[model samples]
Target: MGIPRTPVRGVAALAALAALSLTVTACASEKATGGGGEASAPSAVGGDGVKTGPGVTADKITIGLMTDLTGPYASFGKSLTQAQQLYFEQANAAGGVCGRQLEALVRDHGYDAQKAVAAYTEIAPKVVALAHVVGSPMVNALKQRIETDQMLTLPQAWATGLLGSRAIQVTGTTYDIDMINGVDFLTREKGLKSGDRIGHLYFEGDYGESALNGSKYASEKLGLTLVEQKIKATDQDMSAQVAAFKAEGVKAVLVSVGPRQTASLVGVSLAKGMDVPFVGSNSAYSPQLLPTPAGPALLKDFYYMTAGTPISSELPALKKLAADYTAKYPDTAIDSGVPAGYSAAAIVVDALKKACEGKDLTRAAVVAAHRGQSAWGEEFGTIMDFTTFDRPASLLSYVAKPDKAALGGAVVFEEATTSDLAREYRVPVG
Candidate 1:
């Protein structure tokens, strides 16, 4: 929907699936394991209506991922795919899911909607489930298809409607919920009193539109005024749009655009002397976007929201995971999207672990085993919880700002936020 930023870009280059039936009713039929535990790997049944991956075997479990690796969002796809790969490598190093190595069956869609459909079609019948499918539209394209096949599609992008379906699970806060949280926190904690105006600049797409609507809904709930601007994803210049917002004299700006466009907006905003603090959706926060002169000027007063726990948080377990990740693949960015990818990938590992718990790996048994599994407290944060019932997750999010410690010259944490209205600010750390 929006331009692909680093996180989105990485996912684009790295990850696929086809149309699955939306029918989510659980049914059971007796099916035998292929052989003794090691030889009896999971197999696809006949010419399938949808795609499926080969399942649990004595040695490895094949989990498929469809991402935007080559087309519009290649950078995002690449980063996300690397993240998943690293996580799996780490998990594999630790003996993998349920004593079986987790092997990712990744396919790239180049962020094309049709390609995403085709990718899903090819991978559906081969893997146990789809792990960390990126993009709002790409995932949207295959939602019903995944459902019909009864394959759980753990998503990295936030599209709230997917929450109501059985086949899709999210790793972080929904767009609406994250927007409301940011809006509420800004007002309640940051002291943005009534009468203050906020401006929104977003590209026109499902990603941007969802963000716009979410911001609108939050603005109404928070009793704030919102000025809107729409930009084409292909538009590189934002001087005119910045001029309009500057003319309005709003106190803050909320941006939802890809890295390239976001850079253009920041450049235009700074050139125009519109020093109002900016708030952005997940799209704007990326290490690749920063590191230029434009980064400091535009991002200095910028605040963004995210659906995952920061690597900087003082959680011992998560810290250990991060440390291990760093020790192995010293080059991964491990920023916002990477953690989201890891968390989503981890859940698939959980599912596989459950599927292979007591019996040999078989399609029928793996599907049956995962029927009512709940990941309510795996410790990924409030955004990712699974239950056999009841919305599974709290859908919480955190407010973060840029810092020096984050990878690629971008760091984020709650301790970095500031409110220009109240004159309250957190200490800035390099």
Candidate 2:
């Protein structure tokens, strides 16, 4: 069966309408407080006169980790959780912040929206901030509640639509920015030219739609045709999408789905003799795929864009992180999530430290501290400025390819960069 096609113009129009709706929802909501109204009241007072609120105590501060431990992205979530756990352990050993030991409260939502909402509801009153929330849809489902509760959160997902909430901070370049850069790489280095038809296989929600926004913009700017295949996160097979792309005579394909989908897309495309380069959103690739049957095909033509440095980077900070992670986890295979998790934890830690210095450790204070950060983490990958809430922390991305011999099963092919188009692109904040 042939896949139904929506005119590119129609798709772009719908995406614009959706973005406008999200923007209004984000901007018109009641401004978040220090804590969810009553929850903002100080729970305890430290000897140093540091005011505290929910999740803060005289002896400890608790942060929540809402992740997908048993879901489709389990590999990414588990590695992210482990790396965060390691960072928290290290922080606690170093006497923690604000004279209190840090605690991580982990809850598995399994990538279910209802479960994520339930988990957030149950855990919100107990955490001053979230170290990391794993999925874009999960984050979107909980955005209003998070705003009402005034909890500071760092999301692992980077869809641009998630912006506008002061409480939710995306630590890296947004999906749209990454896609713009990816398209630039294809045009500049991969022999793609104007008028070439390209395929985009994306999930149906915020993550994929946001990425589509970039491809649409890039297609128009570069005089290319974009063929889009929208899928659900639950859909793992990509044979149908591959067939559609092949029928369209697309020159290359971009994926904004999960690792399973990426593997299927690459493997099926190769099998069908539809051999074209595949570029994917960061979440679309996992190191675990390296040992799978699709591994060789992925290595041949697949690359991904990321806001964080690859785990195999030779930077001193990354090297130390790898060594420490190996020492701590022992048997767990290191992946990109190691640095991604640690970088997020580091961001939260920096905010907490800032809040501590001000002697106000309330949830609101932490949010303020985060917003006050103008520059952060050259040690992680790219430097990020969190001073603004309507934009991503950074616009740079690292392009990486799979490598079985690499610690993370991937290595950086291009260091952090923001193409002219990426820099010129105005991300939709809604």
The number of the candidate with the highest lDDT is 2
Candidate 2 TM-score, C-alpha based = 0.89
Q: For model 2, where is the 10-residue window of minimal lDDT?
A: 1-10
On a 0 to 100 scale, what is the lDDT of residue 81 in model 2?
77
| lDDT agreement of model 1 with the native | 0.60
lDDT of each: 0.60, 0.81
Put down candidate 2 lDDT per residue, 1-430, tens digits, no spaces: 0000000012343354345334423432221111222233446666889999998888878888887665555556666777887898899999899898887788877678899899888778878999888887888889998898788998888888789999999877888888899999999889999999999999887888889999999888999999999998677678889889999999999988877677778988998999899998887887666666677788999999988888788889999999999998776667777888888898998899999999999988999999998889988767998888899889988999989999888899998889999888988996
Candidate 1 stretches with Cα past 4 Å from truth are: 1-4, 7-53, 358-378, 388-392, 408-430
Q: Which stretches of candidate 2 lie over 4 Å from their true place?
A: 1-44
Cα RMSD for candidates in order: 10.3, 9.4
Least lDDT summed over 10 consecutive residues: which range in candidate 1?
20-29
